[model samples]
Target chain A: MCEANVYLIDKEGNEKLLLESVDKLVPSDESIMLENIFSQRKTVKARIKEMALVEHRIVLEEKD
Target chain B: MCEANVYLIDKEGNEKLLLESVDKLVPSDESIMLENIFSQRKTVKARIKEMALVEHRIVLEEKD
Candidate 1:
């Protein structure tokens, strides 16, 4: 499965796991839409920070 | 090979492919670090917009 675990990065460079087994990412206005294999969804005002695909990791930093 | 193809989302909601076969994403102070399987790297001043792991896709929106 190519699904990745999503993380949120803070200003202090700290990371927090936000979602797991995410299957879709859609961009809307100033936020991102996240959907998982189970069809769970979340919309957050953030940007793409990093993606560690091989490691099944993705990161996001809060927008100002 | 969990790497994903990265895309940039514009204000108009258009998607542009930015990188392919990306394996790593690191967040610096204000930019995202991208690395592919070939070890090529790019730093983009953006935030994490989305991650569609099932489709091997990731998206980013520019930060203002």
Candidate 2:
């Protein structure tokens, strides 16, 4: 089984977006991606600062 | 780490609903529950026929 999650970050150094495990991650643009799952999907666009893993959730923090 | 997912079923023996993993499950009535998480939450009401685990996602099927 593959555990999945989504996160978003800004140009700073803070975590701005968090998402649960999703079925697919599609990049729509240079700074954005479409997250889709069984329930719903959302669009996230931001400068990626950093990426990390929190337990099972994927943590994405913005760059400053 | 808790890998979670939500499922919904109708009165018959068929799977009609599926949701991503949520932070909590709140039962609002005898046949419904409110799922809450960081992104969003939705209400699901149906007769649960069976429950099982597929990989990490929790599968809930309706009763017939």
Candidate 3:
């Protein structure tokens, strides 16, 4: 239940799914490293726009 | 285990504890509404700096 699906909001205010089951977010150099339950990993250059943990949804900043 | 302790980063890069055992984060108008296990609620105007869910730590943006 701690895991969340990460979404990237576009300039048009649309949500684009980015990652799933994200269990960890580590801040890297100008980016955030996301690690999921299946051990999948990716780095994203965005801040959190919103965190709806209870809903298992995490909205990230708009794309650059 | 899904609950997290929220912290706000100060201008000096110091962490100031804001909320504990927070389980929900709802995006409001220019603010985020946080709700804890104890039913305590608060609204904060900031973006996410980091989310170390495995460590139960949620670091928010610095003060405006």
Candidate 4:
């Protein structure tokens, strides 16, 4: 599966896993929506911080 | 292939195709790196504007 693992990164450079095996990501307004292959969905108020597509890792920065 | 098509979105909300069938994306210092399944590589000074993973569309905002 090309689905990616999502993480939340804080200003201090700490990373926290947000979701696993996420198959889809949609941006809406100021938030991002994540959907897994199983159709499980989640929404986070954050912005794209960094991405390593080949590594299936996506980092996000939470909005204040 | 699971690679995504990359686009550059301007402040006016206009979209411009940057790359096609990109298989990997990596963030560096002040740029984002793109690599295709064929190992083609490119670097752009931009930030993620939005992403539609299921649609294989990745939007980016060019840095000024």
Each model's number of backbone clashes? 7, 7, 0, 0
Worst 10 residues of 1 chain B by lDDT: B46-55
Docking class of 4: acceptable
lDDT (Cα, tens digit) per residue for candidate 3, span B14-49: 789999989887654377788988899998886666
Measured by TM-score, how close is model 1 to the native structure? Answer: 0.65
Q: Between the candidate structures 1 and 3, which one is better when assessed by TM-score?
A: 3
Clashing pairs in 2: A11-A63, A12-A62, A12-A63, A12-A64, A13-A64, B49-B62, B49-B63
Better of 2 and 3 by TM-score: 3
What would the TM-scores of all predictions be? 0.65, 0.35, 0.67, 0.65
Q: Model 2: which docking level applies? A: incorrect
DockQ rank order = 1, 3, 4, 2
lDDT by candidate, in order shown: 0.80, 0.43, 0.78, 0.79
Please tell me which predicted candidate would have the highest TM-score against the true structure: 3
Q: How far is B28's C-alpha from truth in model 2 (Å)?
A: 3.7
- Clashing pairs for model 3 are none
lDDT of 1 by residue, A1-64 (tens): 8988888886777889888998887766587788889899887887777567888876778676
Index of the highest-lDDT prediction:
1
Q: How would you encode candidate 4's per-residue C-alpha lDDT over A1-64 as one tens digit per residue? A: 5778899977777889989988777755588888887888889997766666667778888876
Compose the digit string of candidate 2's lDDT tens values, residues B1-64. Answer: 3435666645564554466655443332244343434556665554223222224343444433
TM-score of chain B of 2: 0.52
How does residue B21 of candidate 3 score in lDDT?
Answer: 89
Clashing pairs in model 4, backbone N/Cα/C closer than 3 A: none
On lDDT, who's better, 2 or 3?
A: 3
